[model samples]
Target: MPELDAEKLKENALTSIRLGIEDFQRSKLEKDQGGDPARALSAVRNLFAGILLLFKYKIAVSVDATGDASVLIFNPPEVLPQADGKGGIEWKPVGKFKRTTIDVATIKKRFEGFGIDVDWPTIDKLQECRNHLEHLHPANTLGEVADFVAELFPVLREFILTQLNEQPADLLDTAWPVMLAHHEFFRDTIAECQASWAAAGVPEMMQPWLESCQCEECGSSLLRPSQQDIEEGASVDNQDNTFKYVCVACGHSDLIAPLMIKELNDAYYDDPRDGGEADVEECNECKRSTFLISEQHCLWCGAELDYPTCTFCEEPLRQEDQFNGGLCGYHLHAYEKAMRDD
Candidate 1:
């Protein structure tokens, strides 16, 4: 078998990286000119793959065990010492047909074992977004995808220059400019979004939800409250019906309740289609499914639920049992039995 040395691994990594960068450049250009958002999806996938390969390349270079690169192979077989004591623990692939490299999780653990300082969380974020894109993504997620790459670019640059001892200019070439431009654009837009959110005077408790909120129509997360309305004596109280938001990217407008409830449900609950239960219950006052059971309040109509006490027994009943007309479970059952007998 031809040897897969560190240099060979480096070449493969560069190839993947270059391809990813070219895709990213095209994606950015397309986005600027109002092209397909799916373009960024390809870039995200390629970039994530290339980043993993770069990490593997570094790990391969660091393995100095008698020039054996079997450590890079996934589930490398171990050769125990023979009876004659000729061989110690050695790594070899179990199957001759195909050899798979270590996966991302394994690579992360290996880096930890080797005391390599990689920004794993950042990488994980990219991987998460990539996975999301592969399954289901919004129509215009170019900004979000760019944000992921922008966050990881500096880390990749540092690793290439300092850890791998390779100049990014030589390796990345034209891709470098594309990465920098997108990064700068991401930073500037993020700053603008932050400023708009900050100036809107959204309550502290609602800030987290707003940060994660995406425009359902356009799939953009660049949503901000209507600051002009807020300035003109509008209230954003959780129960307030006057608050409105606008998606800066798509110019889509919506009321705070619908937007927040959707975000809250998405963040908290799994998909019911996949056997997930709804997190929020129906609000008694507004009759909307925005009553947060935990918080004991309606996100839509702002109804603070007060569980009624059982009329006969004078015991506090849970919200779910409220349908029994102020009766606890036992009392409700007893009343039903009494009614049957009568």
Candidate 2:
């Protein structure tokens, strides 16, 4: 194995420090101390730079470890040896080349090869923030900029520490207590209810989106499907082909079709299908399976579909375009009213 290049690591590490110190000072002196919205642009850019630098450091380490010209840089496959001579192929370097410059996409692809996922949403948000701030982000105040900056540090820190085998104390240790306090502040606000969930027996997977499934009146957890609707035949499993979630605390009921439910009479073993991805088209309004392609109407809600417009109201329906389905709320009500009067 080639010896790890201390010189290469040192160069990147030093650059990360130089950029980080300046980034920290701008956030503190300009944004925090002066409270200048004018400084918000520079401050946010600094935060982005620092975060990217940390990521760059991790990438440098990966390059040193493999030393494969093809794998690390843009060198050809002939320069890279294929077999590890064991069970797997290794990216072994046979020929030498100068280090290639890397950008965000390059670094992202590198980590992905190690089975690490890039958080595209977070990255997209920051890039958008940067673009907008240069053109103008909607939130330009010191606090607004600071909040955006604060949110990203923890995410980057976690990634660096987890994947790079580095400690915050050895890296950005000074920011540790601040991040801890930031968590605590949020715990007292948005996360307070979440902390108590484990004691209340709430599943962890559901915690992130718990607000969406909460009872509007009583604030009770409602992630589990309602047995009441099932037993009452309001949403019978086979007949209605729907799933219902009823709030136990306030009796608020919501129904969604098991539009994803599939039945295969024969040859399911030979030919497979994904019910959720293949056949299901959720409604834009209620987020349900009422978007049946053939029916052109939501049977449960009587919503007017995209295929047919309401004659009286002339309301346009919105549907998953590929499914070519839609429903107009106004016409459905009008038709139901006219039927009742008759």
Candidate 3:
């Protein structure tokens, strides 16, 4: 049997005992407040038991009373064999004694090896809670502590299993039920946050910014009223005629005016033609409304005009060669000459 390093063993026993007492006190408070005090008590008892086991394995042990209860301490046993012909018992001070601190970076690296993205923010939050638990007097209530543990245990257990190369199901026999309850609480909190944000009217910048915008759901912009039309105080011509702007994206629709249909159409298909430019053509049949272009056939009887003719020059004009400003080039020159003679 290897002799234990007395100082190191003593420190380990002391630290575990202190932690156990703290857990015991916390458990008592929780029990007083209708919490599962048994679990907390059990954790503390396990801590002590683990310490006693180290003592049985030839680690150092001692006792002290600092707070309200006596503390049992156990140090780590050394495993190296003796150099002399003496029995395999050797004691050599390894290093300075210090409380066992969790190697966070090491644990994180191990978790990464298992392909789990470590949620740093959550880890930070849990660490903050742990610090609060250790330092704060009249420590957090049972509900608060349990809530913290509930949030932390899943992540911790995951990390532990990954490090140990154990299947999660195998570890779940010890940690699953608590984790499920904790996850439920986590989900509820997230839902509440989402609802609160929604109720607060969190602006959706992605929504289209047109007054006559189509209903996100239906893709029909027919019922939407233009901002200009609405400002003009126009009413729908038929009250019974219901129209809706249907959204193509979300299938949402909004009831709007028939006027909105025209406005949206105009807005969507704006004519690129300049506002002041007037296209003029002459009609061979009547010669009236000479300033009007036969957009489709003849303006008089709707007969398809062969093509536009010059009103002043009385010459047939090709579609592309039609006169601008109501006169062909020759007639424009003649008009200028007549004006000069006058």
lDDT of 3 by residue, 272-326 (tens): 4745433433335434222234353332333344436677676765433443545
Error of 2 at 151 (Å): 2.9
Model 2 residue 76 lDDT? 28
Question: In candidate 1, which residue ranges exceed 4 Å CA deviation?
Answer: 30-38, 74-94, 135-141, 154-173, 199-203, 226-257, 271-276, 285-288, 295-317, 322-328, 331-342
Give per-residue CA lDDT, model 1, range 1-342, as digits (tens).
Answer: 224567776777777777777666666554567655666677777788888888877787777862455645444554444444565554444444236677899888878877888877787877887887776554566556656678778888988888878888778887787787867876787678778667555656556777777666655566767877667756565434677778766677877656766677777686779997776777777676666776767655566635556788877555677678778899889989999999
- TM-scores for every candidate against the unseen true structure: 0.72, 0.43, 0.30
Clashing residue pairs found in predicted model 1:
none
Q: What is the lDDT of candidate 2?
A: 0.48
Top candidate by TM-score? 1
Q: Write the per-residue lDDT of candidate 2 for residues 231-294, one digit (tens) a residue.
A: 5544232333444545432356554223112211111223235433322345465454434444
Q: Per-residue lDDT for 264 in model 1?
A: 72
Q: Whole-model lDDT, candidate 3?
A: 0.41
Worst 10 residues of 1 by lDDT: 89-98
TM-score (C-alpha) between model 2 and the true structure: 0.43
Error of 2 at 198 (Å): 20
lDDT values, one for every candidate: 0.70, 0.48, 0.41
